[model samples]
Target chain A: MKRSNRLVVLTDFFLENPRKHIQLPYFVTICETTKSSISEDLDIINEVFQNQGMGYLQRSTGAGGGVKYIPAFSRENSMQFIEELRKKLEDPARILPGGYLYMSDLLGDPRTVREIGRVFASAFSKVKIDVIVTVATKGIPLAYAVASFLNVPVVIARRDPKVTEGSSVSINYVSGSSRKIQTMVLPKRSLEEGANVCIIDDFMKAGGTITGMINLLAEFDARVQAIGVLAEADDEEEERVINNYTSLVKITNVDIRHNKIEIQSGNYVENHTDS
Target chain B: MKRSNRLVVLTDFFLENPRKHIQLPYFVTICETTKSSISEDLDIINEVFQNQGMGYLQRSTGAGGGVKYIPAFSRENSMQFIEELRKKLEDPARILPGGYLYMSDLLGDPRTVREIGRVFASAFSKVKIDVIVTVATKGIPLAYAVASFLNVPVVIARRDPKVTEGSSVSINYVSGSSRKIQTMVLPKRSLEEGANVCIIDDFMKAGGTITGMINLLAEFDARVQAIGVLAEADDEEEERVINNYTSLVKITNVDIRHNKIEIQSGNYVENHTDS
Candidate 1:
């Protein structure tokens, strides 16, 4: 294959298989080129990736060493996306009857959801994650999106357990906004013992759901490496149960009668800018 | 930017934004090159993509003329993947007590799910799809995966409606295996009227759930362009509710006492091979 062809194919491979390491010889064989030429191709790809604020290729030396693509959204890009999301959320039509904002459309959008996933994945890029855990229904898409970029599997926690899943571990916790007790269950075999986990959800109210997930992870002896939500409600009346998490947007206020909604950029930008 | 860098960037863009049309002038501006050079670059990328069985670029001429990337998996690649999946599903360990198979792990794995999505998307590449619809819980990931490759949005149908989603249209249908009445709901605003939709799900037993989804789409006056499932049960006893659809694998047999399971490649290959 020619250099131009090799560059296109290699770039597609890296984007599709992020965080995966491959030996140099494999690329050389596929490209029908020498190791030195392949190395030069990697250099050019890495330079373009970094220059475009996409990410850089991390290369290691030695017998067992190779190259891995570390996907990261630049700080500028992350903030800009968050800001755009915040503005989109501020639309009056999003306000529901009970001061709830309708965000299912955004979550359902593949491009938007993938972009949100990219932001969260970029935010927690430094953290090691074995698998992504999320609750059923709404959180499933966001979880899978982040898992795709992180190159990990996703284990979903459901409100009801099915016979097909075999045995499971269930936990009951108070719903943050509803203040009603609900059950969350995960299949026993779904996660391995002592695995590192990253929790992802579509929305966060007072963090009770996330806390329940944390407690659920305890049963398997898994460590909570990180937690991320697409949006978080800024409720002054209710006490926040969970801290140390990343959110892309914060819902400040919602007035149903006036059809008004207020949204702002979440703490992801602030935390990531410093790093 | 140089030709090598342009190749990498263009490849990444096409892969990330499949099915999106881009004009030659846009590429020229981004690559800092002449239109002729950008045209040559696109031809190189398209040739490499087609040669690798990834996909090819479709170009048009005239006022609205542009290039669009149609991501596809060749029949050879699709059949190979389905065969591998069939063999994987034949494991006795995957059998549960009630002759059910445990497939959450496969559904949770991003790579596997994405590949499955690619097969389905490629199968329906000729069909025009405005949106992909799926029921809540298990099907969300597959729906999102397919939607990602098709460059379309996803709308989920849930068993129960949430306050944040506003008013919804609900339908009661009989379960295929359980033979019990159940409700399925989709938000009224989630989908537009007269949309070209593709339905996706993780598994199908007697196709009751899919039938319910099809009926529900009728209420919105939307057209069901295509349907795809990861797996389907080849039950001799029950009558299948759906006849027109694509599946990647078929669960042929299961014996709980013997801890044995049997699977085979689905009809996707036969239908696609002739085309």
Candidate 2:
């Protein structure tokens, strides 16, 4: 294959298989080129990727060394996306009854969801995540999206037990907003013992659901490496139960009667800057 | 930008934005090259994509003309993937107590789910789909995976109504397997009127859940363009409620006593061959 053809093929491979390490000899064979030429191709691809603020290729040398694409969104890009998301959430039309903000549309959009996933993945890029754990229904998409970029599997916890999942471990926790008790279940076989887990969700209010997930993970002896939410409600009335998490946007206020909403960039931006 | 650099950026763009159309001028400006150079670059990328059985770029002329990447899987590649999936399903240990297959692992794997999504997206490559619809839980990931390839949004139907979604349309239908009535809800704002939809699910048995989704879509005046399931049960004891659907694999038999399971390629392969 020519250099041009190799570049296309190599770029596609890297994008599709992020964080997947492949030996230089493998690429050389596929590209029908020498190892030195393949190394040069990697350099060009890496340079372009970094210049575009996408990510860079991590290369290792020696007997067990190769290259893998580390997908990290630049700080500028992440903040830009978050600003756009905050504006979208600030729309007064999103105000629902009972002071709720309607955000299903944003979560339903593949592009938007993937972008959010990219931001969260970038936020936790340094964490060693063995698997992404999320509750079923809304958070599943975000979990899978982040998992795709991280090259990891996702295990979803469900509210109701299903016969198909075999034996499961169930935990009951208090709902943050409603103050009602709810049950969360995860199949015993879904996760391995001591697996590092990253929890993802669409929204967080008082952090009860996330706390519940943490308690559920305890049953399997899984370690909670990170927690991420697309949006978090900043209501002072309700005591926040969990801390030390990353959020893309914060809903400081939602006045249903006045038909107004307020949103701001979440802790992710501040944390990113501090780091 | 040079042709080598252009290939990397263009390939990444096409892969990320699968079905988005961009005018030739737009590419020329981004690549810092003339229209002729951009055209040559597209041709080279398209040729490599087609030769690898990945997909081809669709181009048009005139003022409203542009290029879009239509992702498709070749029959050979699709069959090869399905064969691997079938073998994986045939594992006796996947059998649960009630003869249900424990496929959450496969569904949880991003690569496997994405490949399954690619196969389904290619299967319905000709259909005019506006959005992909799925019921909450297991199907959400598959729906998003397919929507990512199809470049459409996803609307999820849930069993319970949430206050955050605002008003919703609810429908009651008899679940084919249980022969019990169940309610499915979709936020009224999630979908527009007369929208074309593709239904995706993780599994089908007696087609009850899918049938319920079809009935639910009717409430929104949505058109069901296609239905794709990762797996379908071929139990002779239970009558199948749906026929006009595509399945990747059919679970013909699951003998709990003998710890045996039989899986075969679904109608997708046969339909593709016939076409």
Q: What C-alpha lDDT does candidate 1 achieve relative to the native structure?
A: 0.91
Taking the tens digit of each residue's C-alpha lDDT, what string does model 2 give over B146-259? 999999999999999999899999999887667789999999999999999999998898998999999999988999999999899875778888999999999999999999
Instruction: Please tell me how candidate 1 rates in CAPRI terms.
Output: high
lDDT of 1 at A210: 95
lDDT of 1 by residue, B1-275 (tens): 89999999899989989999988889888889998888899999999998888889999989978899999888888888899899989989998878999999999999998999989988998999999999988999999999999999999999878888999999999888788899999999999999999999988988999999999999999999999999999757788989999998888889888788988888797788611
How large is the interface RMSD of each prediction? 0.6, 0.6
User: TM-scores of all models?
Assistant: 0.99, 0.98
Q: DockQ of candidate 2? A: 0.93
- Cα error of candidate 1 at position A250, Å: 0.5
Q: Residue B91 of model 1: what lDDT?
A: 88
lDDT of 2 by residue, A1-275 (tens): 99999999999999999999999999988889999999999999999999888989999999979999999999999999999999999999998888988888899999999999889989899999999999988898999999999999999999999999999999999888888999999999999999999999998998989999999999999999999998998758787888989999999888877888989889998898511
